[model samples]
Target: MKPKRLYYWLMLAVGISGIGGLTYWDFYQVRIAAVTRNQRWVKSVSELLHSEQASMARWIEKFSIESATFRDIANSRRDVAALILIDNRNRQAQRWVRPGLRLEPLDPRVSVLQLRALETQKTTMGPVLIIQAKPYFTVARPLGKNRALIVFLDAARAWGLLREEASLWHIRASIYDFEKNPMFSSFDPVIPAGALAQTLDRARSKETSGIVRLPRRLSWKWLITFHFDPASDWIFLITQHTTWAYAPVIFFVICMAGILLIARIPFMALVGTRREETAQALAQFAGRVDSYIRGRDAMLQDPPSGIKELFPIAATARWLIPQWKRAEAFPRDLALERKLLSLLVESLPEGILFFNAQGGVQLSNELGRVFLSLEQEGREARMVSGVQVPRGFLEPYLEPVFTGAQPNLGKEVDVAWADGKHLYRLWVERVEAEQDKTGGFIVVVRDITFRKQWDYVQEQVLSGITHDLRGPLSAVLGYLDLMKRQLGDGAAAKVLEYLRMAREAGVRLSQMVTDILDVVRFEQGKIDLVIEVIPVVDVFQRIKNTFGVIAEQKKVNLKLAVLGDSNMTASGDRKLLDRVLDNLVGNAVKFTPPEGSITVTVRSENGRVLFDVVDTGRGIPREAQSRIFDKFQQVRPGDRSAGYGLGLAVAKFIIEAHKGEIRVESEVGIGSRFAFWIPIRPPDHRAAGKSDALVNMDPNEVVFPPPAA
Candidate 1:
């Protein structure tokens, strides 16, 4: 026991001592590096400034031309203030100076160096003059017995050159001339009142560094002050804060913490009896699996024995508990969702059935069974994925759906059964399984017998009424025209104006009824397109002729642009295409305010003809753009005077009958642009004969005619 106690004490002592030693070594090396770096910076900046001065001096002594070369050098070198030439023999002085030089009055003491240069006939450097925080150094070079050249160079230029190099080594660096006048510094640090003078005195001595404490703070900083005395007489410095200088303590603390943590292992082991730690570790894992299995949160610790291998299984089980819980609830949630869906389907007006791939009824609503004439005698059965149902009236439709003749998703078709009395519409859609495989088909049935009869009756009534009314309306308009022509010279002005108004009203009513009848015919797919080659230029001319008078009357600008060849002809019905343009442009003219403009543009691209009628007008609202093509849907719904809105519906049908598409884009305050594209190809069977528009056409498609009233 005594031996073990002594061993632990020794380990504690060693650990503490090692931590202290490492701390000392790291700090010592950091201090050494800091000092070396400071010395290098001081020496490098001093040497570079002097070297630049020396080079300038040599250039001055070698240059031949007096003013031009000297002025050139002064102008090029910003550091050079001016170049002066003194002729002792002729007693004439010439100077080349740079502009904007706010140099201070030269120190009288610099004359001593100038005299010495003349006496010795050798180059000499004068005292530095710090003018407005800039160092101006003078170089005196004697040229034979008669001439002396004096050059003034600014050391601030060298600061700009060497400042980047100093930052690469020391962050805070500075320079001063022999007179202790300030020169250049990179960093801004608050210093004591006498810090600079004291630092300069220290730099003058053999010692190159000292410490300066900041005022009102507990921090002291290192000041590295070095100078070139005889050669340049310029002092250089670097400042380092104590925080960065003492960062090594943090590293030492981390190492000590690591050591202390290591010592805790055996200490904890000794707290328990021999093999007691292993038993406790084994104990922590015992309840982990049971707790996790019971769906309780459990923490697992790795066993300190060979049983740790089995520990991962318990850990993985801990991770998998949430997934297991989700899977356990999934079946219950799915059953509830299925029950809800079946109830919703049974309540729907249409009958819906889901069939699996094997021709079995997997799921069917009550309405679906009733539609299929099925009677269930048992209690309400729970629907399953692969349940079977008896074949009945729907079996024939099922065969077509199962075969390749029908697609995965098919259009709804009219079904007439029970000797055509029972009319139904059926749509079949695929319910895809995993990986794009066929799962089943979802069939929807809606009985449309009453709807069909209602529509037929409405069509017959509309036809009779329209046919009966159009003639009287046209005759009223015609007689009004004739009376205006014959009685205009004799009739009162108000009577003539009333006749005109009546004629206009009759024309609008006639146009509305005619458009509605046409829309019905288009919906029944009775109208056919007369496919022919349409001359695009001729079409534009006709548009201009048709709308030019109306647009002029309204004070609206109507322009036409044919962005295709002069002989550009498209394979489409000429009259139908004109109607499309007329409807679009006519609306533009109708809604556009006075002085607003409309553009009718036609272009051919990619084997298709594109048309655009853009207008600066009272634009259609965004919500109305979609519904404008719908029958009787006026852009401005409150304004019933907009010709009953059947014009666009008719235009849409005509465009579709010719195998083309039309769309409208409008903003409330801006304008509207109706654009459409038609395939410019030779008439195919559908275009030349009859289109699917005959049966499947939307009243939302077609073209316009003669600027709809």
Candidate 2:
């Protein structure tokens, strides 16, 4: 066993043994002593009774002799009592009789003579004075053999006196008559005489004086009886209820011993074990003197302010500080290895490869498999290298990650397969593993496909942009020339209208330039947000006015519906938001067939203000929707002369910058709905600018005078 375990068991045994010894002592020694003391007390009462009986006998004999005027023994006793006391029959007994004597019936049988003058004549004595009956012993003695003298004595009083003397021994006493009647008791008798009669009879018949049990008439049954005889055929009994005299002390002593054995012993053993454990622990700690000093110094140098903050720090220092020192070397070496590996990969045209700590391939670049001709190889062909090679055949030149017991890097090996058509340079590098047993590697692939496709798309897009830009510039230059030519013509109304048309064309070109610039700026994150609260109604009104003219020119009907309260508003950059509304509404007006109706609506929903522009237009196709918001991407084969595709992309950027969202839903035949939502509450810090409101008045409110002819 361990020393600690042995010590615990030894101490526990000692505690148990000590408690067992104490319990035995209490039950046997202490309990027996109590019982013996009580018995002694009862014996002392018996001795007292014997002494009192002798004294009473002597007193009676002397009194009988002194009062004699004898003719013969019995006749003289009676005649002398008759001569001395019969004449005083008329007097009260208390005035004539002495303290212990009473004269009632006396036999007149003989003569009387004085003790000084007469000769003694002996005959049988008469009976003693008859006494009144009571619940106690009555002492009677014959003046002659057949005659008797009786004295009334309360036996309960004598028992009470005995109890008083024996109080220190916890002895209790009570007196009973021949009929088992209580005459006197030291304590209030818990039992009546009837319940005890049988036991008392047994005690009387057997002439026994010891503990005898009996049931009480009222409460308890068990009692101890001690009998003493003071005269022939008369008994003095001192009985005590056994429960009070002996049972309580015995029970108390037993319970105390049990408590010590069961409770205190175990507790003391546990405490001793804990104390020894603590001492051993202290000794163990003292053995590490240097560590103890270091820990103490650390604690004293930087005492933690609280448990919450300091415990984690202490635990970390105990474990991680040494680990950190060991870990530093590995990571530094691994970092250098990684740098060199990356450089080696960058130097090569073909990709390099690496693996995780478990020696499993983690990263792969383009040329890795092509170098070995394993790209299309079957499972059998791919399992060439000895790395956890899956069940397969050997390929031309494939290698597995090599992770020795310690991390290691392998040399570069060229993989040439199938007539030198495919080539690859494979480099494997080792990485430091995590404590959790995971490691990682890097792989680079070089595919010559990029070098092949580069020249193709670049030429196409550049040529397209040039053609697209030149057409708009040509129209603008042509319009400017016409306006410059018209500046000299000045041909009144018709010429001014022509100049206006030319300026309008130039304005279109300028708008295209502005759209392109906005698209670039948005993509580069240079666009600034001027956020403010703009009313929903105002945005609807702006959309209506801006697109209504265009709709009219196209012969499309533009309608406005303003819902929700007038106070409802949205927070965003008003100018940019106006641009978004313009683009959406303008598109609706542009795409819708002549006489088709377009509607602009604004409402509040779900803690946000929403704007919707719906148009009965030819909607976008499903395939085009994915790329619709991309810069320079236009709907397929649309009227390309009017604008480039930067408008919707710019609108998407602006809405996103304002922390709002926009989406389009359309069915090609059913037309489209472009909706956007923005927060209703403006920031407390930024002031809002006014939005010019537009109202869709009730038709009844419109009154018109007859047109003048």
Candidate 3:
């Protein structure tokens, strides 16, 4: 046999043998231990029974002495019902019977007890007896010259004591005389008839407690019998059942047998299958390894064999082949990689430059050379050209990157190049060597002159529009209002209502213009927040008053809830905060249909005051939820009456200027909740200055012509 197969067989044999041996040894030890424990229990029960017997004897002796003394007293006074003293002739020697007391002679059972006491010349207690349907037990004591005194004890009381003592041990006990006649028992039914004789026969021979199998074969039961009083030939018997005690051993044996039978089949099959599989895997591995060494990648096309031991070696061989090929042609691969990198760099819109450790230009793309005003030349001339660029321009930016002083190496600096005719955003980065030391620096430059020029033009246009439109829009709204009042309550009352509606529209248009101007001012850093402490409850109440009438007119339930510390205050511009609240609440009321509810909730959270405007209406779509705060972006763009969409955008701006955040959550058919937070104390005024100008641009930049008559 092969060594591997032999080893497998040997291991199987050892395993089976060990399991069988341990099972048998454990079973044997358990059985022995169970038997020893049972024996000890039996001994303990026997000792307890002997102690009970001794106590009974003492009580009997005390009763006998008391009865004897009472007999003497009764002999002096004939008040007792009956008192009799018996002598050796089975006759009463001294007797007293009260008048009208027709006492019978002593019972015939007392003759046997008296005989026993006469024979031993000691006290003797007899088994219980019945006379005239009343139960009794007799106790006899020897007098001098073959005479004895006998007293009958109440049988019920005597048996009750014995039963109470036996119950403490949870055992049922019975007493029998030498002839095996039942003297007293805890229960009426004694041991089964077929087992009684056997139990008695064992007790006679053993002279000590011994377990005897009972006739009932339902479960493991034994009749444990021992002599309680040898001199009186009285025996004690108890029944014991031990099936529960032997259950663990029986279950373990069955389990071991079942496991041995079941395990052998699988183990044998596994041994043969594993050997065949190992051989097949080895053959496959050899073929794959040969293919790999021959530089053919085709070996990887086949699926892996399910052999854990060979997988790592096969994988390593497959991986090493590519590395080996690369190593053989490393110079060619390196040139190709460098050429591809250079092409990629040159194709980028931004300029890229590489500087060596000595601050000399090692490589520069065409854009980089043009941006830095460097001329293409041989290596030495290229270095001289790099020196021509102002040292003050490059050193301040690149020195920190190359010297490792600035761990975050990328920064955008505006550089004026080509004699101040161009502006480039110079991004400087550090390149590290193998040991993380500064190897060199790479600078990326992007021209932003066009972007700066466009921003300047946009600023001028927004300024002119803000200046030109506000005056005329306000005049148009004022004239419309005056015309509405002038045409009041006559046949033109309907026209007056139409005039009012038109004036409200003009007013909204004017407000939109004002919002755009304010947005521009904020973006230009020309607006300052007049920060002050404002009570949140007062704000909630003000919002409630502002929207209450509009909500009633729309038949929508507008409610305000202040949660947790209604007296809370936040630091912000009161007018700005009021504007934010007005915007959010107005939006909520606008979209919400009749009978739909709008709630404005003010709560304190995380050291900030949070405001939430939730509406149960046609909810915003998930796709539009993110852009709802963006200027002029409406959730329902088809509905142009949704009020210009500038409200949420303005609210977001004002909230963030207070160093806060605004977020919206919405699902298509459920509802929408717009939430914003402002801190308890205002942040640095300068921090809010970091607002992006692009975000704050006017969404409706088109200048409308004035309304025609």
Tens digits of per-residue lDDT for model 3, 370-477:
655542232232123233222434444554445444432233344445567655556666667888665766788778778657756775686689779888888888
Model 1 quality (TM-score): 0.39
The candidate, 1 or 2, that scores higher on lDDT is 1
For model 1 the local lDDT of residue 225 reads 35
lDDT of 1 by residue, 471-524 (tens): 888888888888888885889989988987888778778877877788777777
RMSD, every candidate, angstroms: 22.2, 25.6, 18.2
In candidate 1, clashing pairs total 11
Q: Return whichever of 2 and 3 wins on lDDT.
A: 3
TM-scores of the models, in the order given: 0.39, 0.30, 0.39
Candidate 1 accuracy as lDDT: 0.69
Worst 10 residues of 2 by lDDT: 690-699
> Could you say which candidate leads in lDDT?
1
Candidate 2, residues 1-709: lDDT per residue as tens digits?
A: 6665566567656766665666566545644454456556656765676565555445445665436532232342221222222112252221122234443452222112111112222221221222343222323333333233333333444455666785765555665544454544566554446646655776568654544444344225344555634332233344443354444446656665665566556567776987786666545434443363445434312322322344454555657745665687788889899788766665666665555543355444445534433444454422222344322211111223232221211222323545553322222333446673435543434443444245236435544675578677777777677766767665687867867787777677667766765654554456766667777777777676666677788899888776758767778778988888888887887789997988777777656666778888888875566456656778775768536777888887776555555666666987877776666665322212111110111212212211111
Best-to-worst order by lDDT is 1, 3, 2
**Deviation from truth (RMSD, Å), model 3:** 18.2
User: How big is the RMSD of model 2?
Assistant: 25.6
